[model samples]
Target: MIPVLWHLGNVVVDLVLDVPALPERGGDVLATRTEHTPGGGFNVMAAAARQGLAVTYAGAHGTGPFGDRARAALHTEGIGILLAPRTSGDTGFVVCLVDADGERTFVTSPGAEASLTPADLAELRPGAGDLVYITGYGLLHDSNRAALLGLLPRLDPAVTLVTDPGPLAGDIPTEALETLLTRSDWWSCNAREAALLTGLDDPAEAARALQSRLGRGAVLVRTGPDGCLLHHGGRLVAVPGFAVDAVDLNGAGDAHTGVFMAALARGADPVAAAHRANAGAALAVTASGPATAPDAAQLDAFLN
Candidate 1:
């Protein structure tokens, strides 16, 4: 079988709104624009699929309209949905408020995605050399967290686990968080998450410290439009990113990660993969909507 990229993360709909600025604690503001689409873990799988990597979403989808959208988006992207539709509740959604500077604030209302069991995890069935993508959201909920921890050690040793400590990184229990990072074969996250994990405010320091703990594994700290800091094989290098006028920062990190994993699956060098990821992210941010990572041809054109 071709090496597959399995996403053991939640997929949800995003209700995105464009605003001049964030509202105060007891304030209100009108949105300049509004959009609704499948987001969260979906972005990574979509980006990977765009690069011709076979991808699968091994998470729960609910029984309502939101779940319907998630399933439709996955099918349109040609990504396989590994788990059956969840019945307890509809798939969840997040309200994203984008400010003028492209920063975002999110308010989430979780549903069926927060619930998972050992039985649900059994369907993951990853193959040797397959890539497993884990988002921090999976570790936030009690049920999902237990299921993931139990399934981690059972995964085939040949499978490479990539964990991205998302915005929820701070809320994850210390022991569990450390365990996840220690067990991961590859760790990718933004500068804020790097600090939250390592207690080092400096991105470079956090990258070095985190990479050292991985033994033979690698770590990447994304720095937005400036690019990323990649620490692998005892060397840390700043992989320059393509600078662009960022209209939206949503899905940029996911684009970078999906492209990076696909590159590694295709046997590209780590540094070269990082370069592609950075370029792919730059292209993603230039677009207004999420799930905007470019195809191979677009990436090549940008690089050339």
Candidate 2:
């Protein structure tokens, strides 16, 4: 079985508060309700685990209440943890304010997730047929960024590197972005993130631009509700999304990515893998919480 080396470290507790509307500058508003769940890269990890993938999480999980919770969550999802050396700080948390429309805004607090080092990655040995998943959050942090960059060149040449630049793609330094693109075997991003990275509004064009920049990789541009675009081998294919009543859009993209990678590892073609991913993402948004991705049975039912 192919392993997915998930470079996920920022295991955060998300305090989700439902509010009528966002407050204006210097204003205040009362939240109707609040809930907590494992978040951050946990979303991606959980999603992949649900697909029955062999996933190893390579990140820091500190010794604290939040870390304990993250550890429990990972175990529950059957995800293997390759934590970085223990650090002084606790695990991180984020305050997510969701409006009536389910749009979310976040205020984050960094923690052990930012403590990744080259040494930690050196301990992880990925061989051919393995997929290494990375997020832009890791690349934005100074320490983690350096470690990730330094670890890239040392990875097995046949190991595929997949990256999701997240919302912070625009903030990554040009040199770092170039290096990441050069090393990436597959680039995944939502429409907004695609626009931020490529300055292209059209998802297809953005995928093409990213693929061109990567020179030898494929690109997947996710278009929420409308599905995703896959660009590879000088061809572009539109993988249509499933139509579902979305309750929360939080982990949909992460679910798509996780399921997509799992399908790839299972030897599915790119388009077929994307179809399965789209179904998984559709099911994800119909529920709540960041790590509420469907298991393989649920995904099979949804796809059927």
Candidate 3:
């Protein structure tokens, strides 16, 4: 079987509000535009599909408007949904306040996607050479974490597991984080996430420490402007990023993860894939939305 990206993470609706700046404590501030779009794990799945990887989503969703939008997006992106939607509640959403500087703050309220059952994931069966993407967001929820932990062992050992300990890496329980990291074949995250996870401010030291936590897998620590540090096997490589005027920071990391995994699945070495991923992320930040990750031709054009 060929490599397919199986995303076992949460998907949510993004209630994006563009503003000039954040409000003061207990103060109200409002401004420009608003958009409701699918985000979270959806960004990574979309990025992978855009790079020509077949993708599937096995996470729980609900039977409400947010869930409807989420499924619609998955279908539009040509991704398959393995689990049925929950009958009780709708999907979750994140209220994103994007300031003029393209930085964002989120207020998230998880809905049905926060609860996952072993039964909901029974249909998932990844074959050899498939790429499985796991996010740290699921570990934050009790039911989701239990279900995710249970599902991990069922995946074929030949399938590569890529773990991205998401934004709030500091919040994930240590045992759970270690279990996830050791089972995963590759770990990837940005500079801030690395610092938060390791409590070391320096990216290089953080990368080394995080890499040591794993059994034999590699680590990638992304430094926003300077590109990424990839430690594959035993060698550490510094891959430079393409500089662009970043208009939005959201989904840039997802773009990098998706494209990087896609490149690796398509037979590129870690360094080469990181180069492609850097270009993909650079292009992603130049756009305004969460799902703005470039497709093959677009990425090629940017690289050229």
Clashes of each: 0, 0, 0
Per-residue error (Å), model 2, residue 18 = 1.7
Off by over 4 Å in 3: none
How many backbone clashes are present in model 3?
A: 0
- Residue 204, candidate 2: Cα error in Å is 1.7
The CA lDDT at 128 in model 3 is 93
**What lDDT does the true structure give each of the candidates?**
0.89, 0.84, 0.90
Scored by lDDT, model 2 comes in at 0.84
If both were scored by TM-score, which would come out higher, candidate 1 or candidate 2? 1
- lDDT tens digits by residue: candidate 3, 211-283: 8888768999999868999888877789999889999988889999999999999989899999999999999
Model 1, 183: alpha-carbon shift in Å? 1.9
lDDT per residue, candidate 1, 89-180, as tens digits? 99999999989998888888998888877788865668898999888998898888888888887888888899998988888877667777
Residue 210, candidate 3: C-alpha displacement in angstroms: 0.4
lDDT of 2 by residue, 35-144 (tens): 88888888888888888888888887777888888888888888888764365978889998888877778888988888887777776778888888888888778888
For model 3 the TM-score comes to 0.98
Which window of 10 residues has the lowest lDDT sum in candidate 3?
116-125
Candidate 3 positional error at 225, Å: 2.1
